[model samples]
Target: MWRNVRRPWTAGRLYEETLEAAMASRPVDAEARLSSPPRASILLDAEVQPMGPLAPAEDIRTDPATWDPRLERAYYDGDLRAGEAVLELYSRGVDVSRIQRAFSVGAFGLSRLRRMVPTRWSITAVDDIISARLRERIKTYDWIPEHRVYSLEAMGNRWVVLMSPGVWTYESIEAWYPGTTWNPTEDVAFVGDWEGPLGRVGYAGMGGCYYAARLAVTEALERERRQARVLVLREIHRDQLMPLGVWLVRESVRAALRGRPARFDTLEEALEEAGRHLDLPLRFWLRVSETLGGGRQETLSRYL
Candidate 1:
């Protein structure tokens, strides 16, 4: 009777279970604040379960906008690969989030080869795929004429995107303040990863944030048809109490890039401007940043 009643959890169920577990296990007052219920009834960490058979929305089923030509072509083609399909769909103006959702459901690929992917894996994979395609094209474009710094602050997180005239290289560093979600100790925690002109080989130590920020910067460069060495510095303050998703990094970076940048004639000047908005010192950023090394000026001056 027990065996008959039991059933294997689907991938979506497993994912939700894992996420809830992580949230519940976090040792932070902020987590408590996040899950705290208000006077008015509101959904918090709630899952919706349909009581009867589920059906697609009429707009989604009948609307012509729901039909993605690129995805349709890739879905039916036996020869079209997933990566190529993603790039084509992206080039044709499909939303990144939409692509990620479709890819997670195995919507783009040969019919026989299709399979579901975990949501987190799908998000990271799509970011990496799109960024890689953009990187190749960006490398062929001319270098940015000057050093540029873009900054934005959201949800107690500060982002500084610094781009300097050079061949294609990228780096992302996150400084977690003391008492923050990831850093409960008195000391701040710093984690970073970098890649050269040829790009990285294995997974970045910084994980999804690395890929997300990379995608944002590459998209900016591709739009300008320019190349540059980019360094993304994110500082998560104590007020940022809990962990939000990597979308924070991606969307914040995109917003920062859209704003007018503080331009400079040299990398050193750009670093100086970027450091003004950050809690950390310029020397510290230079210490951890491979893209903006302590001797970055000396290295670039040789080529200049």
Candidate 2:
């Protein structure tokens, strides 16, 4: 009746009217995503970034921020940055995982190079070494397996591998947590993990080997600091993730919880148990966080 009222409204007219009415009725400021939760990117281990120095502040080392980008790019690709300083020096170009300044490569990278040099290995031969010789070293040494701590080392050093076989293999990394929408193009480097890369890193990247690596290094360092059974610090031949590795101290507590312990149920209990096993200073660092930097470990006992 209304369509025919004024002079027979056509179907097109009605459609136009309907659209206009609908658009007019809508709010000007209506948010399309009113229900979305606000999220932000943050580092899991901010305090984990080391401060001061292994020796004095003056003796402090290189800056990571200024590290050569080419090397970083290579590392982001699927290449393992192994071998001696010259050979294994990671670069962003192609398949090289360059070491950031200050974060030394230590023994792992060095030994890999030493092996490669003597063997004059082809790429296939080198790949075989990763599983055979490297894997063998991992089996025999406590250091190779990874730990709760890592030690700094000088180049051209001879060191025995140290690390135990790891349990709780990191079967997979589900996602690159949080930010995924942003484009990584144009001089963009986020201390962020891309889902694909992280998955690759995640696959065989479990908490146990990490725990072993950092723990052994820290134990040795603590001993050195206290001048009690000082273990000689070894050079990191590739980019060492020791400081980053300590974040898993919390995971250690979790790993400990998996089994039935004689003493307790909570991770706190396991931590306390582990603490008692370590000396006072080392235990102190363990408590504050997974570990402490050289400066933090020395808390100015006698006021200057």
lDDT tens digits by residue: candidate 1, 90-154 = 98887887777667766666655666665677788999999999999999999999999999999
Judged by whole-model lDDT over C-alpha atoms, candidate 2 comes out at 0.26
Q: Write the per-residue lDDT of candidate 2 for residues 165-206, one digit (tens) a residue.
A: 232111111111122222224321112111110112342232
TM-score of each: 0.76, 0.19
Cα-based lDDT for every prediction = 0.74, 0.26
Model 2: residues >4 Å from true position, as ranges? 1-42, 45-87, 90-133, 137-205, 208-304
